[model samples]
Target: MPKTAALCISVLGTGNIGSTFAFQLARTGQHDVTVIARPGSTRLQQLQRDNGITNHRGEHAELRVAASLDEQQPYDVVIVTVLAHQVAAVLPALQRSAAKCVLFMFNTFDPEQLQAAVGEERCAFGMPFVQAHVNEAGTLKATIGAGGQKSRLSQQRWVAMFKAAGLPAVFEPDMPLWLRCHSPLCVAFESASVLAVRRGGGASWQQAMRIARGVHECFVLIQGLGYRPYPSSKKWLAASPAWVLAFVLWLLSKNFTFRELLAGGVAECHALIGVMIAAALQTSVPVNVAAIQAMNPTA
Candidate 1:
């Protein structure tokens, strides 16, 4: 669809990611945007009370709000912004919905199973590079495509839609493999961030070394499974020397904004590690399970 044409969109999950997408899409005033929040969530109450989604500036995007998916209603697309762990619970609803397309925008090492359930033809994947949050008082604070960053979307139509909504997105040829390859580093970064938060935001060279080791093991395990760590940036992360990667991670670890974006990502870290180990069992991959497991958040 052209960027100017209107389409009915349902954004499931109303946390930072959901609200960010909803606010931007609604602001375009071309698409019909409806954001779904949990029935008892404070986010739902705020959306209803304000009767719209707001950016950090207190400006409103006059969008529709809902607490659940209307499976019977035919929507042009349903963009899921929830975490991978949360996807299972919403799968049944999505499976029953009449939406023409389902675009999942989140981190996941394994998306094939999701696509199997969602149906391959209509299923789409996206990796969000935006830094966003719904802060207190129900305001959205977000940064999109800063420093030439671009989110990767598997499908072209959705890419156009995100760009049209003022959210930067680029098309990826093999999103599933890209996500799989990206998972290892994502877990390392998130786990380190969890530990850093516990340390009161201090960067630890020691922690960086351990996380770097975990990343290397993760790369090895996935590569043994015949997955190419595509995208030049991820390729470098996978093939670089351990000490070099550690230094880079240590540098990023000191940035408050970087750590903040990775905060509360412990659940995702744990899940990705588990999936990695599970996938490794099918191959002769020598994964340093102990070293990788050390990155899990205890707190």
Candidate 2:
């Protein structure tokens, strides 16, 4: 692809991840970016009124807002940044769109279902590594990756696009396994944080220990299902003694930033835990996910 060739891109959803990505991509000014939001939704009106999105520091990036994907003028790429449980709602639109590629950038343990819904050739997978949230004022508070930090994606073109837009991207050959491995760690962190909040304070050392143990079990379950945790570093969770991992979690819980991130992601974490537990059950793996399950029993 030519560096100057403008790619038409559409972002589905107006949540933190979607808004943050749109802001970054719009800053490049090389691509024609449009955000697809629900018709007559407040977010759509906000985006249209603001004529752009602003970051926490008040940095702005102009973008186009649309009510739906235009089948007549298909986008070069459509990035889905909805929560794991919300992907199904947008499948019909994506399937009918003229987009050449559809990148799912969220946490999910069931990629095969999404692939089947969208067609394997057009479906791609990625995970945004930014900490972002949309405030009541519609400002996107985001801490995007810098230096060597980059988000994970599976396609070359998408990776190049993100990098060119100043958002670093790294390719993961086995995204499904990568996501599967990451699911439990995310659940554990959120569960610990929820427990902390419920207890009216940050995570205690004991709560951190329980979270570490939950992560260890999840890693074991992944191995039992005949998949090695991707990125290799996660293998350390299984390798380290429970006490050491607990100490690390305890230390991390003290950080205000980490706690805030956990709070924001608790809902998605609960959803993913359900998916992971279901996946484990299908494999006849007698995994102990009670800790994760207990995180959000009402869900």
The candidate that wins on TM-score is 1
- Per-residue C-alpha lDDT of model 1 across residues 27-81, encoded as one tens digit per residue: 8636889999988989899999988887877778988889999999899999999
Clashing pairs in 2: none
Give lDDT tens digits, candidate 2, residues 137-225: 88898777844578999887788888887677888988877888888777767766666666656778777777777777778778888
List the lowest-lDDT window of 10 residues for candidate 2.
290-299
Q: Identify the candidate with maximal lDDT.
A: 1
Candidate 1 C-alpha error for residue 107, in Å: 0.7
lDDT of 1 at 88: 89
Give the alpha-carbon lDDT of every model: 0.84, 0.78
Give candidates' CA RMSD values in order: 1.7, 2.5
Those runs of model 1 whose alpha carbons end farther than 4 Å from true positions after fitting are: none
Clash total of candidate 2: 0
